[model samples]
Target: MTVYQLPVEVTAFARWLTELAGRLRPDAGWYGVFAARDPEGLRACFDGAEILPWDVVESLLQDAGEPADGPLADRARALYAAAATAHDRRPGGAGALAERRDLMERERRYAESRARELGERLRAATGEAEAAGLENDLAWVRDDHARAAARVTELTTRLARVEGHARAEPVPAAQAEPAAAPARTQTPVRTPAPPAPARPARARPRGARYAWLEESAEERAPVAVPVLPTGGAAPRGARFGGGGDSAEAGGPARVAEAADPAEAARAAANAVYALQRLRAQGRSGEAHVLLCEALNGPPDRLPALAAELHRAGLGADWSTLLWEAASLPPGRLAAVAGVLADAGRAADCDQLLRQGVARPVEELAGACAALHAEAHHREAHALLTAFVRVRAPEDAARLAGADPRGLVPQLLDAARAVSATRERDLLHALRVAGLAGA
Candidate 1:
């Protein structure tokens, strides 16, 4: 419970768990799972993540024989005993539940028989006064019978539901029930519902485009790569549209177009909030596609969409959004990045500045060149400046490994005709990154 106690508990617990797993027979129905898992790997997972491995303990309580005979065996048995006592104390413990069901059945049967006997007595009564007394007694018995029958039915249905669910899936490893539950109640503690199997993560997503996603991959289920929605695949009336006339016509458009952009951004939070839910539900593939389309959509919509997503919170997904945001045109790109910063995504902005993740070197050069040819000096400087400031060494190294891709000339050309004063800071950062001169 205290920080000082954690290290000791985790080490001992992992050993006890492994020992129990190793001792489990094939008949215990848990040998296959333990055999498949590397003991060291399992121990490492426990140590690194402080999650109480209630699922493991529950399985051991259910089917694992016990700790193998050794020094740890005594400690393991003590733990099992404490947990077993708690388990039985819970309102719906295995043994207690059976006993309660039996008691309820007997109560129901007795109530029904008493009601039937009282009814017969009422029917046999001769005098009006006697018949009235007998009828009153019969009515009370009937009510008791009905109440008992209902209670029995409810208990039976609840038990059946719990058993059916237990068969369908094992408890989630993250179920929060402590070894000692906080409260015990008559209402049964329902089993933790297991999630459905997820699609396997794709090999390709761990490459360049999705490299940033790998940082905390161990903390979550492997997210599968998303298949971008095609024209036909797009929801016909999807509230969150990607761009253009269709965006203007969609439900989300009305919200984004509100008189108060801030108010609209707050309201539009649900769009990204839904994406968060999808990922939490292990539908990361869908979440990935939705994010790319929304954040990197039409230039006109980028600021509002970015605001909405930032408002809803991206959890540990800043990299994904910045990757998608990288493809935005220079002006829209800067605007969206600022919105992310203002909405408390300053850390994400820092990542952009450092990594320039998903920065397409050739694409940026061409876009900046087009701006310069049009005599938009400041804008050209802004574009290149943004890229240089986000000095991703990996990207530069990637360029170095294969081809220069006109890096020097691209920087030179972008700097020409630009207002020195207006773009001074950008030029300095660019120079610092060795991509340009003062």
Candidate 2:
């Protein structure tokens, strides 16, 4: 028995065949082995797998009985047709189409304008020879214009057909196959995979406090955020320590130890700003990891750092970072939660509330209001109800006091659902105050 290694594409094709046929076939295994040795040869045998040349694949699928008219068959036929068309147009088809359309339009306009100029010249000719010459030139211009217009029309029709096929529903397999297959004489050009582009160095202004915040002239750099090690420790050499010092002792550490809090805050702010730039450049995952470093650093500077992030339009990214960290200090948790809620990420805000319920009531009130204002009534109801159930009656009362729009009825419903008598009683007091419906 001849052993054969299958390429990834051939394996995928076999899987697609199995799905379409609703049963595995021995031939699929053979095809997989056959494809591994000669993908180009297999493609040739199938007469170009680009369009509807599915004669070979379809024969294997039909072995298990013609596939029932279902989503599987419909999708397979449609995907096959699309794959063929895409393969045929792989050489900058979209860009080429646009450029051709523009060129034809310009040519048509120029020809029309030239014909008009020649017509005017023909009228001004003083002799029959000049008049005849001008008329000939005008005729040539008119013919060119006509040809350009016709070519434009042909291209427009072709483009419409291609676009229509793309948008059309998948055809049945029986209807999908061509009545007569076209000859496949041309060999496909195997374009080499392009190398990854390097990130360009960005120029920064002198004395700029947060140079990373300035938009770079080059394409955004791809930054992979390093995952925190187990036990939630900051990565080695991460500069998140207080007094602008990294925990790892070094020259910068020696200098940071002597720096004032103001200088430390500025350094920390710049680091956070760099994370923001990463987020802006579509590297949110990496930025999130770097942001977690801040959480492990100085807890005291979190509010100021979060505020800076908020000002830079990265409130959503910061919310995600804070939520992922899940170990923020109570003060920083409340501050970040408020920012998240204000930014309309009520889900993250709710999680924060659940984690930091021990924080001062005053600090939690803004987030609660933001949730309520955004009509995240369910989350707000649950958070408040949980607080009422877990905290003392006075703390729950203070929470109720913050509810100017009267969420007592919603809280009562939540309390009743959970069978919490204390929460029910607390809501009843607010209901008695006419803040809730009877």
Candidate 3:
């Protein structure tokens, strides 16, 4: 059963809940309409589809197909909290929590793999705007991956702790260790090759001792990993990292790095993923040493690495790389400056802009506007000194006329001081502009 959008005039919120309960009725018989493996073709089926990880809000919203926004969407809006808390008080066993933990681990690994793919794209990106956007997306993917990793760790560690407590006797470390997987090192991307769904180790009702561990992924709060739209958009000729597995596997996982981006991007992505995985595993010393090695390549490699770092949200490392690349030719400086200005790094941005900028006059204005939008001291001043140099007399007149953010005044002041220097010509243009405006 499905209710695409709740009726607009529906008064009580309980009506919406009634429909949701119907749609998500727990597995009762042989057929599971609401199951992760919906047999009736009523839901979107992908690999590793479980009955429902109600804790994963994205899966619910997607399967529920509820209109999330607009006037018609108002009634279903209450489900966000309800659905996130669905499993909070549900009963389960040790094996169930362990299964959920394994699911989370699979999801975390999938997210990291996706981050690598995004980093690969960042490598091939050339335009600063394109690179900046790719980097931004990569950063989002990275953050999401971190959240998934945390959830996995949380589930893994908590279940172990509680299970150990419930044990009748002390189990040997070698025989009864927690379900924590070893620290994930950089390895080839593995596509999940889940076979027929049979009861794997975690599927049994081993004990009800860890039922308390059945708390909703959201209830245990550090923020549950929102399932991203890593939907069925598999890469050509092969499935990418996200799909194709989220269940107990019957055979060896398939290696799947062939669909990744080309050489430059692939290498850049590999380094980034390795560093992040190492750091997440608490191998900071290894990550640091690896990072140093990655950064030690020729100067030409700095920009790509820096861009990738930025995309990965490694701000400190990104900043360092950017500074290191500062000595390179200024071909891409203007574009980089545009991004920096948008990021509120006006001083650094302007320095790059002033060193030399090759972008069109119009783009410069846009960059200045971006900077001004970010900060203004009586007026928006980005690489205005550079701006005045390339600006046409008409533009000079225009800028001098309004002096939005007092830009002309600042330029005029600077020109007054630099008149005896090489840029003294700027003083004459400002004068011409000021006279023309008058």
Question: Highest lDDT: which candidate?
Answer: 2
lDDT of 3 by residue, 123-238 (tens): 99889999999988888677667656555543543354345333323345454434445784443333435765643334322221121122332323221111111111111111
Model 1 — TM-score against the truth? 0.27
Error of 2 at 330 (Å): 12
Evaluate model 2: give its TM-score. Answer: 0.25
Between which residue pairs do clashes occur in model 3?
36-50, 36-51, 135-311, 379-405
lDDT of 1 by residue, 344-400 (tens): 655454444322322344334433333443344544454544443333333333322
* Per-structure clash totals for the candidates: 0, 2, 4
Model 1 score (lDDT): 0.43
Note the Cα lDDT for every prediction shown. Answer: 0.43, 0.47, 0.42
Give residue 251's lDDT in candidate 3 (0 to 100).
16
Candidate 3 has what TM-score? 0.23
Model 2 lDDT tens row, 22-138: 464435653454456566755543433322234445444455455733334433443443343343344444455556656876887888779878888887899999998888888
Q: Is candidate 2 or candidate 3 better by TM-score?
A: 2
